[model samples]
Target chain A: MSGPDDMQGDMPEMTPDEILALDLALGALPREERRAAQLRLRSDPAFRALVEGFEADLSPLDATTDPVLPPRSVWEGILAETAPQPVRTAAPVSAPKPSLWNSLALWRGLGFAGTAAAAIALVTAAPQRQPLAPAEVATATPEAPPQMLAASLAGADGTPLLSATWDPLRGTVVITPAAKPEAEAAGTTPELWVIEGDKPPRSLGTIDISGPNAHAISSQRIAGLQPGSTLAISIEPMGGSPTGLPTGPVVATGKLSAI
Target chain B: MHGPVVRAPASPGAAELVQLLGRAADGDAAAFRDFYDRTSAKLFGIILRILPDRGEAEDVLQEVYVTIWRKAAEFDSTRASPVTWAATIARNRSIDRLRARASRPAAPLETAHDVADAAPMADALIDTMRGAASVHAALAALEPRQAAAIRSCYFEGLTYEALAEREGVPVGTLKSWVRRGILRMRAAMAEAGATA
Candidate 1:
């Protein structure tokens, strides 16, 4: 594939269709030209084929570029817009004011240092911490209106181990551990599971034990999350349960409740 | 000369991606998330090539994924590879943004000159090197000026007028260069496909 072809000087003229297809594929046409090409694309199958051929020819170049990891916010934004929205009652008569749960700054500040219990406490006390005037409340109804469900998992002795908040609208569950899991010290990892009734526990995947872990729930699993569903943490070998069923001892479990 | 490289089925994960997209079309959010995790970086890289600004690239990346989610059902595996289909969306969105903007920043024409060089592939895309190598080989077969013109227009998302102005050439001449480049590339790729 290397070495130049000898047909440079004898190159044939590109027909008008070829020129238009090339220009369209290259995205080099001006607005007016593009509109015309688009029209042809819709009405003319032959022209569209040429364009597709050009697109396929050019696409390999995309693979020649290095990959770049986009910031997490981009994925968050995508989930916000595309995640399935659960059926709910109409907006509250008095819309809820923006709270710490809605604040990115607060989340960033909490980072990994803040305990899950402390975060839950802050969420519970957020209204009092920053009391909004009636006018402010009326004006501050967040777009999409935050719908959050939180669960505070506790060890057998009733000691809070971790707290999780599920924002269905955002399709994410933020899990904050109060401290390093005992399993982490024992060469095993703590895995989160969602148990809904008689069905086997479904792994929500291994989560970061050291800090706040935000796991995006898939649409299928998001449906399983509700007020009564139980969230449990289990100790599993390094990666997580290999059999899809929890093989480790259940360390903590909690029931999700609407916040 | 090296034997012709097969173009389609560039990545081994192509079939898995097809399944993921099918699942996403069925409104499986988990499958969609899996798809996103696997493809976002590659799409982001494609978008960033055209829109150099990180903020702008990120915005396009978000837009691209949303489009992918919405249009997953429309994906025709017989027509294009999974990465190509997604990359086309990324490139088109980024180019649209580039055209809408008043000034081009970040990806200058000079930077696009390096496009023929082998780029480091993401771990998920390591299997695509054969396809990329064939494309590089095809581009390498063109006249330097024609190859450069095509690369600049593609990687920088430059319109004929913009690229012509930068190259200090007439728009018609620039179009001729690119059109000829496209034809030669198609021929070269066709030849490679046949040999493979």
Candidate 2:
């Protein structure tokens, strides 16, 4: 029987550069060179794509090994670690504070006192928080409140350009100008877009670099604010992208993920 | 041009995995559990290959899933399939652990001994995953020695020097085989439309 290796006679030879790329992909390079190649991947798109291609090419090798079932407790441990920590509330009080260390009411009162102090301190520190009507503030949920997503958007070069956080409950996307190359920030306003799987990019709103970076867009307006979507920032005109689509070079991109 | 290649056996459940990852990213606990059940075994196997110690491998596997939980929103299906994306994470994490442990000198001998007796059986290496048949076909195309070098380097996270020493070949010869083997395998996989 003609074995599979027989077909290798016709296989084309790989160039030295191709071999080096393959070596880098296999993690077979010497220590110093491997580190150099990995650093290059961060700043070089062509190099990154080449490495990624090797990853994709060799991924099938993973299938050859049988899956070994992990212990069930591992899953439990993951859940325990990843589960959102509930904000600790003050313990219940059976009676009024009794100046006794063991009394539940004293401890509960102390907890409330500390919480109130921290809230006061935070409110004092952040003067930018717009004061809400007491009536509107009272409508906030009593239970575990909805959390927002904050992502640090990076460019293809892996440099942080803008820090963004979208609060679904509050209907706001907060953008903070970060360490971006000067050329990227010059001559254009930064516009944000949300891209879901295979869907057209939708504009969330323009980010005001001079003013508060927070832009108010309801969750109803942006469909892909959830996970599996990407939050990309592109340079645009003062009013935003005139064509309603990202027209300029994408300076930074980050996928919308849980904080 | 290497365009997109369809992964045959595209069941709704497979597609649901991507959606489930999305929900898990939203901190939906149930969806996260389902994602773990579907994926953890394969990830565990990948980690175990590098770490050798079951306990350490399990620990790394746990970290991998947690990273997935935090970064599932970053799982762009357009960029990579779920298994490939996850395997990359597992491999990278395992490599990181391996590097951290490299300072200690107790590992090489034990790992070399294991490699001596641990040639995987042909049948044991086969699986029903969609790309397995194609990959196996391409790997089968290599010379047996070339294939072993590739497998040992990949599965065990062996460096060229380690693999060369273990196989009792000059480092240069082994490098030649590995590079040539990889090129042939890539060609065959591309022909099979299995290259990413």
Candidate 3:
């Protein structure tokens, strides 16, 4: 009624094409321009839902709440691994050259680096670094800041996932999942919480409960971490809960630091 | 944008295993001892596949190792090759900083690598692909131009501007083409039961 294209009198209609374009755009933009785009999309209810479904793709990352980097020593460990050839190794003018076995040791180190890279290649489709020798490591670009993890949601249960620690630094907690989630189908998503003391669970986020896969609970999922017993994930809604309490059943559970 | 909600079938032997990625991230003399014992040449194979900068690809190696150190916990043996999973993560990270916004008219296909991981969880992913193939077939049934636009948008990551450039049409018209194409494609994919 406010805009010229508004269906003030006649019901509006959208061709499938308009809906698709909007669906495509929905992947790039947010829901704010729905009014203007709605006209382009012809305000079709089914199309709108389709667009919503498309946007749902990025939810997995959203559910995670870690600072990309953890407080763990892994970052330091990585730095140490490629700690560099000192960048300026004193020009090595008069030092005695190392023997062939030393060279073999270096080759073995290189081989190890190579193997590690290969192992990573076999696991993730992501690129990994070549193995570094005992020397020749270089300093990383200081400007490339590590990713930051943050809390996203909370729930009725006493457990929550925590924020993520960026690359270069990572620590971990493992959880044993309950039997098949459908074993307790309440028609809600499994909620995750970071638990500490006797306090209510600090909601981290929720995990998908629709399937029968073992969900990995990472520290990068806390809503607002507090001192708690462990990180627990329960079920909740797509957008998550308005209340902090989790109304869903617990799926995977783990302690942040087994105390 | 929210990429896709479909849970990427769990990654097996993902980069999260400490025993797997310790040396790479550790960069320590002792750790690298273990690191090299695991994965290597495969990492190079994938990086070399896409990134032409051998030096740069090698540079990414360090980051990948560091990522492994910090993320080994996230890896699951049920997903895919540690290499493929790690490669995907590395590629995504590399492109994340280099990626252009959706509004850009030029689609960087040369720089883009298709999201193909090795064949471990290939079974799970293959199921999705079979499903996608059905959808693709359904898409094939649509008007050629219309389907082209949808394919360009969904799989190719093209903007409307780029679509127009590819088709040599006006932006507004291209916009219309994409919209219509998607509508038909969505219907087709859904009817085929390949959609999530």
Candidate 4:
């Protein structure tokens, strides 16, 4: 029976005219009309493949570029401009240095001095961070300070899809909702995975997705995700894939580039 | 030769970070201060990639942080974390700044194509704030041929056909090299204990 969790590889493909219509539906329309066209085109595999082809053509855009960081005071200048008018112009260079929070991130970066945030947190949180069962491990409390996330893994082509800061030694991997191409976001669950040390990718669970998208994994759950593995996102069903073979198209994929 | 000493400590969670960013958005000078400190250096790195020169990059960096403070309100908490949002602002601002600068008597920017061949996907590619070093380190681990193919495609602005010609391989072979290289890299990272 075609119940839940069954794979549907037998779907029919799209025809040339219909494919063109779908392409036009997406390409030559206002944002509102495009959204409508997307709905119309969803049932057509050929059209979906066409769209997927476009994404394939564009994936190289995600390749990681090496950006050289500048002095900390420069950012101070930027932020100082945001202060009230009087504060903005008058806030002299004697700005109070950010507490450990400011310096915390510097240590986390590869170009900077000091150990990784994660390594530092281990020392402080060792007393509290107890090991747990696998499933429970998925939602463990982080030993690192608050401000760090676990989304800094690289996608395909060694492109980083996340960034981070450190809090009392734990690293933060900045994660955003998987930015789906136009006409995406319907009936798809974007799930994250971590691949460490040749082990098959383990599920890091689903990102919140959409506007309210939240990065799910933090320090407590980071271990289950595995480090140094490529982080990937595959478009699964509403919940996720049961086969674990990346059944749906991969939305974005990156590896864990530890800096 | 000495590199920084290190240990693998734990990382922070996104939920907590959203809250921190939320505070920064609400005029928590401390939060803004901390965010600026944490992200500016990385933002500077991103700026330098596009802008190159030190003075110009610093100027752009300053403008980027200003934009972050003013636009923090527009941030969709779920859409992007503080770092990603900040970095995006920095990157986009840098691109714009670079465009303006180049228009001031340098080579044209809109040469053969406008920006990266694929922008949104490229955003997914180049613009992602996934930790820079870890991802690059993984890329470094790939076979030279495979890595070169991927890098050329992503960074050096080489078309697959162009890459094929340079490598003395068929176009299809070049494509396969990039694809396989990516897959192999993924496989390698999986072995490296990577998590999302």
lDDT, model 3, position A195: 54
Chain A fold similarity by TM-score, each prediction: 0.43, 0.42, 0.26, 0.34
Give lDDT: candidate 3, residue A219: 49
How good is model 1 by TM-score? 0.56
lDDT string for model 4 (B1-196, tens) is 1111121221353344455567876778788776665555556655555555667778767766665554455465543444555554554445434322213233232231213222122122222334334445556766677677676544333345555776887765565555544444444444443343
What TM-score do all the candidates reach, one by one?
0.56, 0.56, 0.33, 0.35
| Each model's Cα RMSD | 21.6, 15.4, 19.7, 19.4
lDDT for B175 in candidate 3 is 59
Q: Which TM-score does chain B of candidate 4 obtain?
A: 0.53
- Which digits, one per residue and each the tens of the lDDT, describe model 1 over residues A1-259? 2244334323356666877777878888765455345433433556766777678778777767777777789988888757667233576635543322222111111111111111111111112237779998888744443557788875422335579899887888899875443324455677788877546678888877567878887878677577666777666777888899766555556667666
Q: Which residue pairs clash within candidate 1? A: none
Best model per lDDT = 1
Q: What does fnat come to for each candidate?
A: 0.46, 0.41, 0.05, 0.22
Which candidate leads in DockQ? 2
How would you encode candidate 2's per-residue C-alpha lDDT over A188-239 as one tens digit per residue? 6767887665566688877764434678886667644675466766667768
Candidate 4's C-alpha runs over 4 A off are A1-73, A87-259, B1-10, B13-17, B74-81, B99-146, B149-196
- Give the worst 10-residue stretch by lDDT in candidate 1 chain B: B109-118
| Candidate 3 deviant stretches above 4 angstroms | A1-259, B1-95, B100-124, B153-156, B194-196
Ranking of models by DockQ: 2, 1, 4, 3
Instruction: Please give the range of 10 consecutive residues that has the lowest summed lDDT in model 2 chain B.
Output: B115-124
Query: For residues B105-138, could you state the per-residue lDDT of candidate 1 as single tens digits?
Result: 6455335322332334434365455566777897
